[model samples]
Target: MSGDFYSERPLFGGAISSTFPLRFQDVSDIRQVPDHQEVFVDPARDESLIFELLDLKHDVGDNGSATWFLQDLATEQDAEGCTAISKGRQGREAQNLLTVYLANLRLKAVGTDVLIVAHEPILINPLSESATAVGAGLAVPAAQSGCMAMGEVFKLAVSSFKVNDWSLFGA
Candidate 1:
């Protein structure tokens, strides 16, 4: 996917940073929210990345833990394959732990509280006729294929996430 020509446009000033393909469009205002920070779309692939900040203390149910929060979100999307990836502080703040998860969704919402959130999606296409018939590419293999390259690209994007400031919650 990412060759030598990719570029990253930082988001949220010096507070948080990550990279997305330069072709993506910043559509933050489309779903304007007081906390709905940013949204980027890769038009060619129908994929997207969205970032948000949420108030777990005030968000509906006392469903305060990341697990509960994701569960609540799952209600709206009916997504499958939800996997909790990480949970802990996003910075040095003690106000709330940042959470991360992965899911396959037709529609979905994910958040962190007192949380900083990001949603990155990769569109899945059916495997080639030969591979689909043989059921290969289901798990990663030594051979380099379009799917493998795409996975590496997304892995880099997810791994690139970092919190640069804690002021959103406290000092």
Candidate 2:
């Protein structure tokens, strides 16, 4: 962390921003990432961070939504032996309207460790026709030596995340 340079970087046309180490370079364009996602990568470490806007899953409960999403992601990727290493919720204010859920998963099939940080907005903006929640996922190779550092970076990014323009989500 001492050697890493952290900064707030704009995403989705500057509508949203998050702080993370500068070592991660934006690669959404080159990778042809979906419009709903902003992708960043640290090539040297083969680590990636992805921020996504998604339609809230009405069927899923808030208590363990992060773990649910993590497992869903694992299934989507056809990753086997997915195990949840940790899960928790953040934010205590009942009036904040947004609850953050975090889940760390180990995907044995892919040999990758994934940290899923999800924000579930209790009230969906009427202006937003589909988008309801925002989430950030960080992936690090299982054998990586600096996984903890990357995990810290992921936490910083999620905590510092801000919506400069709510209109980006049609608010």
lDDT of 2 by residue, 1-171 (tens): 355778899988998788987877888656687777787866554445778766655566656767787777645534335422111121122122333345543333333333445332333222232122222233223235433365577678877876687676555
Cα lDDT of candidate 2 equals 0.55
Q: CA shift at 51, candidate 1, in angstroms?
A: 2.3
Strongest candidate by TM-score? 2
lDDT of 1 by residue, 66-92 (tens): 556566654443343442211112211
lDDT per model, in order? 0.41, 0.55
- Regions of candidate 2 where Cα sits further than 4 Å from its true position: 83-148
Task: Identify the candidate with maximal lDDT.
Answer: 2
TM-score of each: 0.47, 0.63
- Give stretches of model 1 more than 4 Å off: 29-34, 56-70, 78-150
RMSD in Å for model 1: 12.6
